[model samples]
Target chain A: MDVGELVDRAREGQPRAVARLISLVEDAHPRLREVAAALTPHTGRARVIGLTGPPGVGKSTSTSMLLSALRAEGKRVGVLAIDPSSPFSGGALLGDRIRMTEHATDPGVFIRSMATRGHLGGLSWATPQAVRVLDAAGFDVVLIETVGVGQSEVDVVKLADTTVVLLAPGLGDGIQAAKAGVLEIADVFVVNKADRDGAETVVRDLKQMIAYARREIRGESWRQPIVRTVAARGEGAQDLVKALSEHHDWLVSHGELERRRAERAADEVAAIALRELQARLTDLHGGGHLPAVAKKVVERELDPYAAADELLAALRAGRG
Target chain B: MDVGELVDRAREGQPRAVARLISLVEDAHPRLREVAAALTPHTGRARVIGLTGPPGVGKSTSTSMLLSALRAEGKRVGVLAIDPSSPFSGGALLGDRIRMTEHATDPGVFIRSMATRGHLGGLSWATPQAVRVLDAAGFDVVLIETVGVGQSEVDVVKLADTTVVLLAPGLGDGIQAAKAGVLEIADVFVVNKADRDGAETVVRDLKQMIAYARREIRGESWRQPIVRTVAARGEGAQDLVKALSEHHDWLVSHGELERRRAERAADEVAAIALRELQARLTDLHGGGHLPAVAKKVVERELDPYAAADELLAALRAGRG
Candidate 1:
């Protein structure tokens, strides 16, 4: 399809076209960039909620419940499930989109599972693009469920309008709290599996931890709400949603919401450009341009560093 | 303390000088880029090995053991231990670094415990640059240790020549072998804590899974060796080291060694560029250029897609 037509269909909320368009964008150079340039205007229309936590923490379930609530409000929701995959392997490992039963039949709910796939953040290179797609397509909300937490998942903190971190009970008991990097990134924390015995305790502990964290970060006054949710039963989800609205309000009042979106926008553009340069560099390096240098360095004819410097200089000069 | 003098000292094998100089280069931008360009001739010297696994899987123990054996051969070693920190709070976290005891008073070993405070993948922006410093400082081997078995840790697979995926006795069982992403990236598979009862079972399971993976990925015959190691007691460590050497030879003989290095070099350069752009873009966007557009966006006075288009146009026009 022509780029214009493809964007039009994507804007029309065509899921297959949206997926194909992202594929084309991921594989292309100047055209994908032009597409990004075109889609930027549509980005802020859909409220993006990032759902993240450790694996098996009920993030997926909570996302489902949130999506259901948004749909009930007569809103068109787009679900972007980020999976971790090897670009070398071209796989989206462990996407649980199949588990989102309600959205399968809801035409208004467009669900697309993407992988960082060597894209570096457990998010698709075209994630911001795809979110724009959902936004332009008139989706009321875009819900992103990430594969796991920590560094890669933090990408969502910048990308999303709100980030919900899900934690199960018993997580705060051991050394797990030491590893819970999501505590700070979360706009709202969901103690999922509230039927479990330690739900209240987890909430209490998280509140205290957040309090300590706020004090340490030096004047971070917006308190991250700890919402207890039995996602399996869809309990406390409305409260979670309310917490999201409240957080969004807080961001607006504190002047951080725009700050973050701008940050993400800049990153999105730069990443698109670097990805272009990378693809070109790969072909040159793989075409035996560097092997002779490697052989010479291995033989001590010259050091590897000098050889690399020479190789890059040659590539820059187009003299190799 | 000047860069030139520091470089001189590092070249003369002064570890502290090397570390401090690399820190300066890393902490400063234009200086680091210029110095990195100048020092390009001395890097890619050390054989980099990235060790990753699920938390509490004895990654540090294996690293310490591996460092000892490498030291036994009179090989100088550098261990870069990474702890992932919480993003929101910016609190130091995941301190599994206490498990290592290899570098105390050993001139042959340099251990740096780094926090994944800013960026993820268990490496700081300074990591590759630091590795270059250590390489120039004449460390025979560089060992990078990451905290988790997730996408961020996968960065090691590309950064290191030989990537070891360490698995303990019981965490994330059955599903691990099914993790085609991490499993496929491993050059050496280590079931660390092999004295544990389920060690043999995990190995058997991994072997089967690897066999299936080998068949599935089709061509490009790279054999991944599964080495069972009781890391705490230093049992089977020699065998692990031997397998690493065997893999190295296999990679070289098959010409994969050169290919992989070329790929890593390209990735390293690209990642560096991407990181720089991310920082730059963040600065530019935060500096009051994009807020008017963002305000219009938040108030819904104009749609985001169109606003983004306008923003880009303004960016190109050097006005907003």
Candidate 2:
């Protein structure tokens, strides 16, 4: 488990090495600290783009279309498909890796599906680390595709430099997008399934919502562009590509890119710090202290806040 | 603002005082410590029952019906409806409070809908506190209902003494339920809208799944009963109530009730302790330390793990 050798192989565009490093990240390997330090200097070159929408919106098709479009521009791309494991759908609707077989043998493309199940903090904890692996692996573009605009999906997209929210005709998605706070997080909006009957209505509704949002935001904010896409046929992928490029240019020119990356890094660092502290807390008093304190709280003999104080005090004392 | 006076009025069953106390908990007020301490002594008497299902399953109607049945038994019931603010549906489909107007004027029944939108840790952090408020207010039964079987909903039901997972015919919910791991968490299953077509199919599928699960889990496990009801017509409410009572008896007799409560309290205490530590971490170096560390990570001058270590070390030094 020589992290430097592994990282070196990953940087050389070895697919197996890249996959292994991400697996290490996903498993929270013991040498993760060493791996992170090894990969750090080679990272920060990939541009992250997030695509999200409700079910039945053709998110996977759109992602595959975008990947092809980016590859056509001679850019190496990495696709991280996040399956949030919907309680309603049971799992992701799109068999993304299967749909992406066209690029499977290409050295320039990397595709991985990460399921946010049984992972501590789920998406927020795991997605970024996997993204770091791809970024360090020298991918020019990292596209993160997630199903549904749940809270976790929104958090994942916030890590991207550009977030593209996809909607479609006849899913009642127009009102859902607005109500789900999708307008606030989306840098670019894609009306997928443009070949469908109500595509124009979805686009019009989105336009109105974007216009309303632009007026309310008091700053030099980028006006989100609405692009229509029949992604299944690859009809409007070039337009989506153009929209993404414009957003990325805007981010870099306005210094928003640096600020966003820094903020994302801060969040990542803070989350890791909290997790480390929690692990230590769990290890304290041979891991029996919390359960004992919780017993008293459950018995109504002690309050939760007081119990928390005792746990924190014990943690502090152990640190000494 | 006087914590003791508020707790006193709450225990006296004053609706306004109870509402005020829950609001304090939702807002995470400074006196929450005092409130928890005051409420601790009066807690642990109420039976906490959780009802959850996907949208369009009539969770609100079922909850209203259950409230009436409990009131008929001369029991004061409090309903804590958690709205998880789904990104797919936007908000809860059931205008629960509006639908529960039948019990609005009933002094013996109190209904509250807590939206988990901006609260830190969302449902996990706020629901328990609100439940404590209701329990301390001298309610004999507390019904916690949530729409959708997402992760947060599952976590919320884990706090209950008994969890009822509702499913409706023709929604393809049986497979979804099993896939979503609902079978493991549901202490009881209710097929609402049983008068609809495919009701028998749902019941049959659920029976098979439950039977399979029972075989897998050895020893004194309660077999989850499949209860059918057309909740809109108020049919089978008593049967559902009977099932709940039997489950409660099982829990009490088997000592599982205490075990569940102790586990729930431990989770609550751990969440609070982590939040307290996070607050302290945020308050360090005028809240600028994280941003500084994050900038270094973004510049590839430091890795995230190293940055987390730096943040932890700073917190430890600050504590000393």
Q: Pick the candidate with the highest lDDT.
A: 2
lDDT by candidate, in order shown? 0.67, 0.84
Q: Please give the range of 10 consecutive residues that has the lowest summed lDDT in model 1 chain B.
A: B86-95
DockQ of 1: 0.19
State residue A169's C-alpha deviation in candidate 2, in Å: 2.8
Worst 10 residues of 1 chain A by lDDT: A86-95
Candidate 1 CAPRI classification by DockQ: incorrect
State in Å the error of residue B106, model 2. Answer: 2.5
- What is candidate 1's fraction of native contacts? 0.09
* Candidate 2 residue lDDT tens string, A1-320: 88899999999999999999989878878898999899899899999999988766888888889989999999999999886654554543544457778888889999988866656666777788889999999999999988653566668888899999888888753554355377767889898988889888887877777777668763566888999999889999899999999999999999999999998998888888887887877786357998999999998889999998999888887777
* Candidate 2 Cα outliers beyond 4 Å, as residue runs: A85-87, A92-102, B91-97, B172-177
lDDT tens readout by residue for model 1, A1-320: 47777777888878777777667545544466456555655557678888877656777778899988887788898888776442211222343455787678888887777654555333535677777767767788888887444555566545888888777876533214533466546778888998998777777777778877777773776788888889989999799878988988888898888777765665555444344444444555677656665565444454434555556555555522
Number of the predicted model whose DockQ against the real structure is largest? 2
